[model samples]
Target chain A: MHIGALHISGVNLQEVEQKVLDVAVNIICDEKGKDYLIVDDNPGSEILVLNADSAEGSKILNNASENQVKIVFSSSTQSGKNIITMPTPVRVIALKNVLIKIAEQLYAYIISKKGHLKAVKKPTVLPEAQKIENIFQQLLQIKLANKCSLISSTGLPSIYIDGVNGRFITEKSTDDIEKYLNLDFNSVESKEISYEQLNEYSKNMPVAALNSILWRCALACSNGKLLPGHSENTPVKLTSWPNFSRHGFKPDYFKLAAIMAKQYISLMELNRQTQIPFKEITDFYNAAFAVDIIETVTDKSKLKKTGPIKSSQNKSILKKLAQRLGIN
Target chain B: MLQLNTDKIIFTGPVGAGKTTAISSISDTPPVSTDVNTSGEERKLKDSTTVAMDYSYIEMDDGTKVHLYGTPGQTRFDFMWKILTKGGLGLVLLINNDHPEPVKQMEFYLDSFSDFIDETGVVIGVTRTSINDQANIEDYQAKLFERNQIFPVFEVDSRSEGDIKVLIQALLAILAN
Candidate 1:
């Protein structure tokens, strides 16, 4: 019997042709929903055929509509699909007859689903952009040219830095420093201070690395955005590692720093590789840039994804193990 | 019963870096361990130490299993690292942050398993920072940077299940990377 187009999934085409010696079944290939690819409903039309012999096939089958027909040679059960099970040692003619019938049903199903469709919008949460322009960037910018001790303030809410020596003095504790750095850059101003005054201010105070303090400031004040010059799309690597131990870091920072230092990766690529939010990767870049650990990567060939490749079966097994151990 | 014969993840580090403890924290079954009393200066740090590989496995729901093997931390057993890592998935190198030169010990392991790591991948877990706090994570990362290599180093308390799990997950993630 002549049949119409079919988006046949979980079935082999060559085996079907070998079975149906004389019947011509037009196949329309598509990468979309396995069953919906064939839309035409005529006496004879094009069709798409798919076979569920592997994990990828199972994925397509699982995503298929519950109403559409599912044909399987093995005795495997799909959750909701109308499965037409065939024994493993079935005759060739039986397979061809099943295909013809399934193709006709799939076409009629498509014709029935004329304009009923809905767009699925995925929900995404983005970090809010900070309202204030920033205070640390201006101070850090002047740090390059001043060539002397620079203090953001003279009193308790202050930062004492000697960039040349890599020593910094800050009265603001770690918890309060972010608050102080978030203030409007226009309102507060930094001034050049004498070394004598810097020494006196640092008395009984712990002298830490300037980047140790500024790394925290850069991350907090940069507001989920990268500083100019370093594009997210172009690859860059860290010349030196960020001091993650000295201060608290977002979890993604570890992977980002490791991946970037291992090889040149664009910030966009970093986010993609690590599955870390783009905002967090941007913040990491800003902090790394402030610490002078960033270098432009001229050779693009150095880019190779770091991580193990696994088959879908192994991936599921890993997921199950992670869940059983409560590691997720 | 079906068994995954080729799946293995190796754990190795210096003496008293908590290699055995890290394995116990993540393994589904109690890890079979072999340890002996420490002598000389090593005795000052810990009472005993692992002298051979600790073996354990976690059976996934679908009957697939991931085997965990922790090598002896003593330098004398360096030959076993390669044997244990043959056809392994990745390496988890634990370093005692309290050690005088934890970075050096880390370097030793990294060098010892360089070929395996180049073929597979590795994750570092820094244990016992509260004891002495001599070494830091940045120092380890800097050394890796200097060596032109990079791996995730985390401050992990080997006794804490969550910490060891995170380390394993990091190793698995990079292995998957």
Candidate 2:
């Protein structure tokens, strides 16, 4: 349960380190032990905390070509790729979470170095239809946990039973949805809804709820395996921008997806580019696919190269002008 | 009376969005600023506020002069927003991410200049993102999408000439399209 010896060093981190050590019983700050290192400008530490705006932080980061060190930057802004940054006036919860992640990484490293790590056998794959059903059941579980009704927006039970529709009308008001539901499912004994039917019903669900269901479906359909159309070798592109406003998705999710879809790049390539967790990226892609916002493009020609503008000449002029005005 | 035949780009946003700083960063000549000492709550943030407007200019390689006009940030002076936008080729809206309600501010400015945005073009430069990460570039894009508008949004340090240039280039690209 003990996270190995951790060292803490940084101009801004003195108080933070004291507070963290007081609360985190497992983390030990020791200079003698090399299991885990936390530093600002000092090299050889596993975790580097640097002030984003300070010259010292910049100098250290520039000189850090070391491999296998997890960098944690203390800044007032959001953390970028590879490094985990805690906002200034660091919160105890955020620090604890970062430590937990570091502990997991350390455990994995130790196991690999000891050659004790073994590959687990893959589970038997379920039929495509059955897999979708499994996903739908999971979605139901989520809705139930959230105290949401299993009934579709159209007032019919989302989960069909036998040949008749299940009768659990959560909302008694007879609106257009109720009328449509009654006309569509005349009989009560309808079997389970298929994936396509679920997708169609999604249009009626609130954007937030629909996004949740779609994400769950993607996870279930893929069965923890690479999706049929997605792979580490193939490049993926966005067919269209996901209506984040309508979908109630965080715009950041769409931006990441758009960046990946702009060019044909494998998920691994995207991982390298963004340094975001592989699982998170795959989950987002799966959700995007379920909502029909992205596609796999075999033709490389279709991939648009929308890189940043090359401004070597312009940059020089701007730099000189900025220096003159003391704007840098 | 002599009039300068120069195309202009209007920079407007809520208070403390760094419009004046951005103009000063890229302006070839010293900016003509009408700033007054602050006496109210705004004084807590800065010592001065632009009362009227700030003006500067840049000369392109082809000798085309592009005038930069910065509108006063407070809505009390919003009467000048339309006046400043007149004959403007595009709008550069700089939003301060540290503001309590950046998204709301974004919507207000976008709606305020919707007609101008539609007629010409608009680019958003979010300043102080390094200090405030609550509203990132993607969040701005989402807000724009809600209004059924598509515009380029960049995270910029208004004082950085390179960062401002990137924003200006994005605006130019949008105009070209």
Candidate 3:
């Protein structure tokens, strides 16, 4: 019998890896050896001992000519070793199986952790933000298409906009547009206007005012996406003109949606030098505001769906948002 | 609740005259629709109703809501016509001249909504069959004048939301007066 021992650390003996190795090595030894009959000496290989006192196990160990069973020890808490008893001359199948199983366990852990880390690091913007961005792009397209061409007799002067910087364009071109058209766009003055301009502007201001409101909303909802929870105190990306009680403005979802609608209306009312009808703008805004409650509720619900969307939902969301603004 | 305000003006028109696309061109909520007509014809390879008459509302900054009721153009859904016109301030009757009896169809809608017209008045949105027909809208305007008091009438593309809004606003001015 072979008396050999193997020290396998880094594994709790009760764990699957150590147990598998013990079973495989024991099975290989018993199949080829006779009890107390053989004696061999092999010192190069590690040994696993399940039965320490059997004479057949000692003889097999003494006859281990290939140095296959180097050492053997009991598998008790204090033993701290793998079981190696008999030595088989044919093959070392158990050692190979144990190593393969450990590799598989390690590979599985790495794969699962990699997936978990990815889920934890996804983008956190709200889906609604993409929708708003798209709406902005669509508005830009509309505005660009309807952009005034200054037929200065020399040629149409090209206005280069760095981006959708309305304030930049307006500041740059307000004087020129006012001077060329021979109308005092005096709102550019102290942001000032006379009684007549104010009235006409107010009557038609619904659209432009509304557009500004949506612009604010798109701003407030910066990178907003429909997430799966509601956080009321979370800062809305747009500025809220909620305090304008003289006009009966209450900053709610309807007000927000109303603002967006007003924005779209204002965009359309600016047909080069053509004045859009005030009543038409009013009706369009009125119609959109009429559905304010429905939209707000829907917006609230949608914000709870997931993290924000990618950029693809922008165009469709913009078109939908434009209608909500009652642009026509 | 999310009820459409009762006072908003609605533009009720017939199909194949560009209702949904027109409304959507300007509508904010994709124009809340119940469109069996579009789906039905789409499956059969026939004409589709761009706008199925449904309800949508717009609100003024002063909190006044304008509800637009788009009516399907098909005569089969004419039952919806009456319901749609119940509280309407006016109607934008889209008269498709491509129809064999376009004038007659306009008359049918006008006559069908005669009581509503008597109360709220109506406008004519004439879809010109060909661009060359200079007096086509005027011809319908004349016909409308004979049937009802001269209401606002114009050549319009039902697909354009802005154009439709202009038509409705004209009707609104008439109603206000």
Candidate 4:
């Protein structure tokens, strides 16, 4: 099967052509003739990017067809001449090389099957949750009015994110919903129902602010990556702060938030300043982004070097107080 | 280990804003309050009010004591407001969202404590936001933005110790930054 779209698992795909590294992405492969499914976890993805370090790499590699360029995140020791293996946390330049390789392979395969197959559209690659985020984003933008219910494979109660009221309508307990926020949406389809139907079912159900679910979901599914538009090299600041009281606190979230509110710094630079883990910082970014508070720095000239933030006078006292309050 | 009064945090806002409850939430011991029955217009909102202050302390493991002082909310107690804020590290301004024009109340507090806020910093705790539909966290932020103010604002319940700590933690974080 020619790389119609992409299917991904594990590794967070980097951007190609300023879009996510999904193969002929956003376009659905409607017809199925056992042609090929890169199928692992990615919903609309055709290319299957596996971690070469993972045992599942070789097994899935063998399943890929000629037109499909299967990518593996190779470790320092691993090497394969016939297959594509880029480093983990693939650099932009390396990702470009892979895109070139995929293009060549796709063109050759298409020439071999001229007039046999149809064409598909593609965009920057995205993880499964990013695609799901697109739906929530449209709801936020007021462009999408489709009343839908999200159903997962686990047979849990269906959850409805009511864009109208900015609430979640569900019979499921908030605790249960939080637990499954990192839900696999590959096979999960949001059953679009009528507005009347949603109202009838949601009348008596427990409701929560939709931002709470979105906030936690972003944290759960971020997979240590920022959204496609957010560049790792670009600094960011918050236009508004997350309502931590409602969203529930993650450890050190306040610290990262303090920095975000005060300075415009990239995640890497923020990590250096605060000494908080890079992954945790990205998780904070995802949550902040999902809550719609994060803003990328518009002017590089406005970015200032973050100096020491600890108060000169109350440094000791603040540390003591933070310690007593269990935040230190 | 008890090191007395290295720094103090001032909790202030309009009447019924939960300063006393907030102080008690993170205090090491029961707060000492000079609460008395409310009079005239204020009495309609609550039975009693703090005429002076609510005093509490947080003691570190090594005996450093950070003080917490809650100012009386009524403007008539403005004399004690200045007195209580002295030697303070920052302010925790709690606004009762259920009050008519809670954002206005915040503006009043910010104006009253503008000097103290400038010297230190302030974190706002918008209490009773759930009970009030007229205002949300964004409205408070919008007010701050209009005033060219940048401060952390949280939707909080003064009764929740965790919520109280977050406010204080955010205050500390802001000061550090």
User: lDDT per prediction?
Assistant: 0.61, 0.54, 0.39, 0.66
C-alpha displacement of B169 in model 2, angstroms?
A: 1.3
Top candidate (lDDT): 4
Per-residue error (Å), model 3, residue A319: 27
Decreasing TM-score order of the candidates: 4, 1, 2, 3
Segments in model 4 whose C-alpha atoms lie over 4 Å from true places? A1-154, A192-197, A305-310, B1-6
Which ten-residue region of model 4 chain A has the weakest summed lDDT? A24-33
Which candidate has the highest TM-score of all? 4
Candidate 2 CAPRI assessment class:
incorrect
lDDT of 4 by residue, B102-127 (tens): 98999999999999887888899999
What is the full ranking by DockQ, best candidate first?
4, 1, 2, 3
Off by over 4 Å in 2: A1-328, B1-6
Off by over 4 Å in 3: A1-328, B1-5, B37-47, B50-52, B128-135
DockQ of 4: 0.21
On residues A192-212, what C-alpha lDDT tens digit does candidate 2 reach at each position?
A: 443234334444332322333
Worst 10 residues of 2 chain A by lDDT: A160-169
| TM-score-superior candidate, 2 or 3 | 2
Candidate 3 lDDT over B37-111, as tens digits, reads 456654443344533366666655554455667777667777766666665555667766666667677778778
What lDDT tens digits, residue by residue, belong to model 3 across residues A177-291? 2232322222111122222333333331111222333333333222333212323223222111111211222113222322331122132322221343433333323322211
Which is better, 1 or 3, measured by lDDT?
1
User: How much lDDT does candidate 4 score?
Assistant: 0.66
- Greater-TM-score candidate between 3 and 4: 4
* Best of the two (2, 4) by lDDT: 4
The DockQ leader among the candidates is 4
